[model samples]
Every structure is written in C-alpha cells, then in structure tokens.
Target: MLKNIKTESFYDLCIEESLFLEENVEESLKYLYEHGYRTIAINQSINDDNLGAQKKSKGSNKKVKNSEVPPPIDLSPLIETVDKLNLRGFQIFNRLTITYSNSETFNKFIKSNHYKKYHLIAIIPTTPEAHNYACSSAVEADIYSYNPENKFTARLTRKMYNKIVQHGYYFELQYSHAIEDSTKRKNLIHVSHMYHSTGKSKNVFFSSGAKNLNLIRNPYDILSLGFLFGLNELQCKSCVQHTPQQVIIHSVGRRHGKALFFVENVEETQENDHNDLSNCEPQKKKIKMIVDADVET
Candidate 1:
C-alpha cells in the first residue's frame, strides 16, 4: 500500500546493538545517520529461562490466569539517546525480544505490567508449540522473529502464514546473521521461500540486526540483497519502509491497549461567519420618547 508513497530514506527497525551503550553509541548512530536511516530500534533479547516461570501449565489451553514474571529490563539508559544525534528526523525506539518454549510463559509475560514499556515486542519461538502461539491471532506482538543462525525443523504451513499476515503480524529477517555464515544465508533464503508462499511477503521486516558498526549496511544495499533472496521489487522495498512503520503503529496501539491519540489538518473555524454576516446590515438604534412625569405627576 505504501509502494506509491516515496520515502526519503528507510528505517532499520531492528538494531541488535544499543545506541545508548557506551561501547558503540556514537559510532552506531553516526553510521546509521550517514547511511540515511531515519529511525532505528535497540533490541534486547530475554531468554525463555528468564520468563519468570520454570513450570509449564499442565491443562488444556485457556486464557492466562496468573504467573510470576522476571524483572523488567532497565531501559532508563536508552532514554537519553532518544534524540542524541542532531540528525534531522531521527528516531530511536526501545524493543524487547522474548523467547518462550510454551504458551504459558508467553501468556504470563504478555500479562505483565512491563509489557507496554517497549515500543516493540517480538517473540522468538524455539519450539513448535511456541511457534503456534506466535503465529496465532491471540498473540499480540509486532514481530515473530526467527534467527537465521538457528535451524527450523517445524514447518509453517501456508494457512498459518496467511492467518498470521491477515492478523498484521510481521517477521524479521536479520542481515547480520546472513553475513556471518553461509549456512545462515541459505536458511534465510529457505525461510523467505516459505513466507513468500503466503503471497503476502509484504509483511517482512528486513533489518541489519547489527551488533556492531561493521555489520551495518545502507538501506538501499539491503534492498538489493532482498532481490537476491527471491523477494520481488515491491516486497523488498516495503521491507524497510511500510512494513516496519505498520509494526510500530500496531505495537504502539498494543502498548496502550488501544490506538494512540493523534489528529491532523485541524483548522480553526471563524467564531462567527464573517462572510455570512456580510449579507446583513446593522439596523439603526430605536429611539423612544419618555413622558415628562417629574413636572406633571
């Protein structure tokens, strides 16, 4: 849908590294800004073990009732970097990727008070059960992430992928993983094929997913890379632009449990319509004569 709308530049929504960290804050943002990235996100990964519960639910699936949760990640460090670089129209967002092995853990984390803190929430489902949950309509997250480095034995059928795309779920393709190993590149291509089978490859979110400056590539270069991976021109282009924007929009809405408040093209109306009033002429003040009661009465 955003194919016609031209973007001056594209966004790298999944930066595996942090822009606020003392180790690479300056270099990361500088490289991204130089490469024409208007927006970037810092993604932190929390493993399944850290999901606050070691036990799984023994019964059939139902709405999550209650469970303890791990401590929330401290995002206070990234707060200052929100507008760090003086780059024009730059944005930095905090995102968290949680890994879950079972639906119970996923449910508990979703029910946490800390769920809404991040601008984006992504899930890394290591098992088929978790994968089902991740792809289901009941899951409320921006991205269902699969690492290119990992091997996937579970199959994602066409029906499941279609349903996921229909529910506005997006998948992330990390470039850093592809760059690190040839096996990962093959894995990425294979998975891309599965997703393309859905006929809604527009739901893909392509990103550097870089933890270091060396791994980062310009958005245009990534677009070229997408072409090599079997993505059509439109899908590749929207990967960095429209797809991520929609992800953020939906994630923000999910965070608030509703859409964020916004308004545009609001104009102030004239208190009285001068043009309508121009048709009327002011009437002369009515004159009244009072009887001289003081002298006669």
Candidate 2:
C-alpha cells in the first residue's frame, strides 16, 4: 500500500521559529523512527526554531516604516541543532522565497561555512519560475506551490525533468496529487500527500519514496495502502520485506545503542534455520537458547 507508492514525504516544512522547538524535534524524529523512516530531506525556511528570539527582536523595535520588513528572527540555534541531529540529510535552497535575493545569495549560502557538514537534501523554490536560478549542480531541485491545483508545479516538473534526466536530476513534487499521472516524469520520485493533520496523514507513514524518509509504522500503513491499491497477501508480504535489509543497515548506522542482527527467513528457509538453531550445542556457562534474540545476540 505504502511501499514504492508515493513520491516524497516532505515533512520538514514549518516557520523557522517553530521548526527546532524541543517538542517539534522530539515529534519529528519519533515519527520518523516509529514509521521505519531512514531518509529525511530537510527543506529550507521550513522547520525553523527561532520563535522566541524573533519575538524579542520584534518587541525591541517600536516604529516600523517599511511594510516589507522581514520578520525579526535569529536562526543560528536552529541551524546548530539540525547540524547535530546527524540526520540522514537535508535540502539547501540558494534563494529563499521571502527575500528572493537571486541565486547569488543561495550560491554563497551553499558554500558558506555555516552549512559545511550538512549535505544538500533538495533545492526547492516557491514556484516553477524560481527553478531557472536553482542550479543543476544542487543535489535536486523541488518546484513548490501551495495550491495542489497549480499548473506551474506540473508543467515545470515535466520540462525540468526532461532537461535533467540524463544528469540524474530529479523533481520532488510538493502539494501535488498522486504522481501516477505523469509517466514521462519518472525521475520525479516523491509526492506529497494532501492530508494536512496527523490523523488525516495516517496513510503517509506507509508511503514509499526513499527508504529512510518513511514514517515507521509505515509497514503497517503500507499494508493498508496496499489494500487501496489492490495488492494481495503474497504481494503485501513482499512489500513488507521490500527494503527490510536496507532498514536494518541504516538502523545499524545510527549506532542506536543496541546490538543489531539480520535474519532472512522464508517458509522453507525458516524451517531449516529452526532445525539448525535447535540442534546447536549448549555449554556450561552459555546455555543454548531457542529464543532467536537471546542466542543471536
């Protein structure tokens, strides 16, 4: 249901002040881990955590002349915390929408000392018009629009995808419908869901785009989404195990403070393994245990 189905789970979109708040941090990671997500592509200007300082800065200013004045906010701390999370990866946009200061600002930011260890997850602009300035050298470029009905997201996706396919450049459609519509834009890997709230988004956990980006209970979510997509028992089981090995590999990388093991078993394979494990010898100090975890560990 959720496996290799949706294109993208662009979860990290929020105001800078709201992004790195303690509660949001715990919620985001917990959601990722619980849903078996291994990949996270942090977006620019979203998921920011500088609300407190922004408020203080605003309070300090009594008179405001320019209506176009930017919000008063300090983004240093949010940047620091994101750097420390050891996240799978995050995106970098050269020119953010509010300022739209041209690609030069974005180019400098990408090379600046501030974003050294953090890899570029994606480069998304507010609309398709902005994609021109977003370079092909950036990891990937996302053309964003809030309205699901917008034609810019759809049309530019096709044009950019065609131009960049040979270069391995891909598009991540934001606020778009199930991308099953665009067969030609196969490189556009991920798709965002229409669901806005948590409960409405229960189906997102099971979607498959990139492995690490999935929400954990995602396997179960996939099972349900599978039903919607008309899959069967064997197909569903295969779906569950589609990337089991990959998940295990990433879990190990996190050094999650737990010993990890990988066991592959089919009906016949399990029977053979069971017999071999059962027949293993037990020493005086080490008791042979049939429980897989006890013995395997």
Please provide, for model 2 over 1-297, each residue's C-alpha lDDT reduced to its tens digit, 9 standing for 90 to 100. Answer: 111122233332211233335656645554554454543433334211233345467864222212222333334544455467754433211212222324543443344333332222234443444555553544232222232233334233444444443222222223112333453222222233222111122112222222222222455555554444334555444434432222223222222223344333223346656766798944232222212121113
Q: Which is the leading candidate under TM-score?
A: 1
For candidate 2, the lDDT comes to: 0.34
Residue-wise C-alpha lDDT for candidate 1, range 1-297, written one tens digit per residue: 111112234778778644456776666677778988987778877676743333444343232233333344464444455355566666666787888888877777777666666777888898888888777768887787887777876678878887777666788888877887799988888888777765556588797778777888888888888875678777788888888877766665455454334233323236334644685755333332222111111
TM-score of every candidate: 0.74, 0.35
TM-score of model 2 relative to the true fold? 0.35
Cα deviation at 170, candidate 1, in Å, is 0.9
Per-residue lDDT of 293 in model 1: 17
- For model 1, name the residue pairs that clash: none
| Candidate 1 lDDT | 0.68
User: What is the number of backbone collisions in each predicted candidate, taken in the order shown?
Assistant: 0, 29
